[model samples]
Target: MKKLRFSAFLAALMLTTLTACSTTDSGRRTVGQYVDDAAITAGVKAAIVNEPTLKVSEIQVETYEGVVQLSGFVSSAANIATASTVARSVNGVKSVKNDIRLK
Candidate 1:
């Protein structure tokens, strides 16, 4: 009886630990993280559109664990700076790594 009780306790402890480490409702990303990523993407797109010098053919915005990665090709360096600025301005973006290249 004592052995069974110990096994059950160990199982419960393992279950609790696993649950604590599991990802939240947004599949791989938490609810708050998802919202932040969406906000960052929207802000970057808006900035690209508003900037007259930047002619972005394809804008790829990816967020991983609150870090936003901006990948695309633009006409000039100024466009890249503009995009980075746009991403930084959005709330919840921990950092922006600009991988944008000049076309």
Candidate 2:
């Protein structure tokens, strides 16, 4: 019973810590802007994934104030261009920074 109580306490503490961290003020991002950036990142990733020609796992998406940045490696120049195009197609993406390296 004591061990189970400790385990429950640990789980609650971890959950509190995670929730606090998620809401912490970060960089220059207000909490609302942070949420917007997260949405933009998700949107770009979805666009890239929906594109049949690109491998979504090889790309990383980040957004700040509607600007989407794409990083990571792709097998060809075509993939880089495709990623940029897909990112641009996402509704919330203001601009796309394609930094994908050719493998």
Model 1, runs deviating above 4 Å = 1-28
lDDT, candidate 2, equals 0.87
- What TM-score do all the candidates reach, one by one? 0.60, 0.73
Candidate 1 lDDT over residue span 1-103, tens digit each? 9999999999999998776666665578755666667777777667667767665456688877778898988777877888888778777778999998878
Evaluate residue 92 in candidate 2 and report its C-alpha lDDT on the 0 to 100 scale.
Answer: 81
lDDT of each: 0.77, 0.87
How would you encode candidate 2's per-residue C-alpha lDDT over 1-103 as one tens digit per residue? Answer: 9999999999999998766556435446566678888988988888887899999999999888899989999999999998999999888889988899998
- Model 2 / residue 21 / CA error / Å: 17
Give the worst 10-residue stretch by lDDT in candidate 1.
50-59
